[model samples]
Target: MNRIQRVQKELERANADYLITGTTSNMYYLIGFSEEQMERPLLLFITRDDYFLLVPKLYEEQLKQFPLIVYRDGEDPYSKLNLKENSNVLIDDTTFSLFTIEILNRFKPGRIGRASRILGKLRQVKDDEELEKMEKGVKKAEQLILEFVSNIKENMTECQIERKLKSFLIEEAGNISFDPIVTSGPNSSMPHLRCSDKKVKRGEAIVIDYGIKHDGYSTDTTRVFSLGKPNDPLILEIVEIVKTANEEAEKHVREGMRAKEIDYFAREVITNKGYGDYFIHRTGHGIGIDVHEDPYISPDNDDVIEQNMVFTIEPGIYLPGKFGIRIEDEVVVKKGYGKTLNMLQKELYII
Candidate 1:
């Protein structure tokens, strides 16, 4: 069956009368149209038998191929959509709350649910075209990261490195998924640390966590570096532990395994090394049209590991007031094992 057919089958199983999605990646997947979210909500309405798009009249000329329900400015967009009363409706999880509330009040459906229940499972398993595009995007990102790290100099501020990396991504990758996480020294302890003016110093860890966007897909990667050997010997120990954890987890990924099992494979390694408390956050997350998506590799997730599903295996250890170490790579689940898409070695890059 085709994509829409598959969604119809899911909707049947969910006992939902229809599915509504806003201008999000979910809409991009269902159809080829991609538009930014605005007050004028561009929505997709899908049923077991058919599907159509609802958009502001401004998009009428641009989207001429598919059936459209066009509404004028300052007009009630929902008024044209004829929804069945007392019927179960599924809405895309990422839809804006304003639109969601309007949907709830206007439709008065018997039940409202997240479309992710049907869409997430379908989106997790990628096809050949998607894997090929992601592989190329990930390889280019790996090259850019290597180049970016090679040029890192002592005393350069984190912001400078981020600026340089952004230039590299825009020049080669076309776009970026999110702002780069550039941190050094104690700042590295915070996994989500944003770029700052802190100067890069010798004997300190530097974490460059970044992602690139290509062909509407995303590539996420992280690598820890240092101007020289870190001042704390424990830094090297934690780096080794993280590296081992990433490798072990990737090595054991097999179809039919639970997503949380993958998390355990990595987390057990870190915890066994005696840094259980220091290792925060899940092992990884799925990457595709959006940087973060389904099949999240976390301690509590029980989603099955299916073939062609792509995700990340990232393991880290943080030592507050000292530094942190992390190694991340995107992996594609195959028949018997998971294969990493990254070409760069996970070894700590020492300048």
Candidate 2:
């Protein structure tokens, strides 16, 4: 069935009278209509048997292919909904408060609920077209990494590398999924550190975590690099441990397993080596239209792994005031196994 039909089924199962959402990823997924959200109200209304887009006159022609209800400038768009009071309605979690408040004041939905309850599960198991786009995104991300590595040299500031990576992503991949992280030496201990002007030096570990956007999909991966042999032997040991953790987690990814099991597989490897406390953050997160999504591989999430669900498996160890090591790879669950999408070698590279 088509996406709208699938959601209609969900609405049926939910016993919801109607499903309403604004300009968001959820709306884009359902009807292929996406635009930067603005004050102008653009909404999608769906029911068990019918669907329509309500947009401003400015978008009337742009979205002509779909069923549309258009309002010109200066018109109160909310009045067009004509929703009945005490109706059962589901709203997108991403809907703006301006619209939501109007909904509550006007419609007084008998039961207001979040659309994520239905959209989240449907989005977790990607269709073939999404997988194709995601695979292309992964290849673009790998290319960006290779270009970054080829241009690396000693004494370059982390900000310089970050700028170059950004340019490459915009030029080659069309956009960036998130800000590229280029941390060195002690700065590497911060898993989400913003790039700084500190010049990378030999014998200090460097953590390069980045992602790019390709055809509306997101790709994320992390790799460790060093200008030369690290000054501390512990750096190499930690890298190996993190790499093994990433590997074990990927190896054990199977359909029907809890999302937390993936975290345990990686955490088990790190904790066994006596550095569990340093392994901060969840093992991984689902990556798709958004850089982060559902089916997160975290210790507290019990979502089951399902076929065609794509996510990441990253494990790390940080030594305060010293350095950090993280290895990450994106994987897609198949019939009964998980396959890594990244083509770059996980082993630490000494330049």
Candidate 3:
């Protein structure tokens, strides 16, 4: 079923009067309408029998052709919703703030529920159209990384290389999925290290984990670049271990497998090799409109890996005050295994 039909089913099952959401990813997912997040609230109030896309008057002219509700400044949006007392209302709690909640309270719905999970649950398995857009994003990102790396120099600062990343990406797409992570040398040891002016040099590990958003879908990848042969024996050994861990997980991923087991598939490899303590984060997270979404792959998640569910498998070994190595790939679960979205060579890039 399409997104709208799927959500109508959720509303029916929950006996919800309506599902009201702001225009972020969720709104787009529901109706394919894209708008900027603004100080003024833009809501899509959806009920089983009605579709009211409410927007501020400022945008009404552009969207006037479409039959939707429009409210101008100095108006309470709650009035437009035509909400009833004791009505079961579903909303996106993550995007709606307390002020918005207070406005929602004016209508006195009997119970207010969160719509994030219901939406995510329906989106876990990508449709063919989504897969196509995602793959296009993947190809663009891989090309951007490879082309950028070809010009990477030993003495260039991390921030120096970072500045040019956006221009390169915008040439082929819209907003980036996330801020590109560019860490080098000792800084690479910090898993969530922010990009800085630290200059890369020979024998230092440079970790580049980044992604781009294309056609409402996203692409994420991480590739470690060695300015030259990384001289640190420990860094060399750990990178190989992480690579092996990533590969093992990919080979074993299939539909009907528990999400946590996939985590174990990678975690066990690192643990057996004596670096389990060093592998600090969850094996991976689900990827879609948002870089991090549902069906998270971790030791605690029991959600079964489903066909068309795409996620990243990134395993990293970080040694404090030294260096780190991470190998990540985005893949789609299949009948017996998974297929990686990224096809770039995963071998260590000895620049």
lDDT of 1 by residue, 111-216 (tens): 9999999998899999999999999899888878877787899999999999998888888888998888999999999899888899999888889999999898
The numbered model that scores best in TM-score is 1
Tell me the alpha-carbon RMSD of every candidate.
Answer: 1.3, 1.9, 1.8
Question: How large an RMSD does model 2 have?
Answer: 1.9
Between the candidate structures 1 and 2, which one is better when assessed by TM-score?
1
Q: List the residue pairs that clash in candidate 1.
A: none
CA lDDT of every candidate:
0.90, 0.89, 0.83
Using TM-score, rank the candidates from best to worst.
1, 3, 2
What is the per-residue lDDT of model 2 for residues 263-340, given as tens digits with 9 covering 90 to 100?
999999999999999998999998888788887999999899999999999999989999989999999999999999
**TM-scores for all predictions:** 0.96, 0.93, 0.94
Candidate 1 — which residues are off by over 4 angstroms? Answer: none
What TM-score number comes out for model 3? 0.94
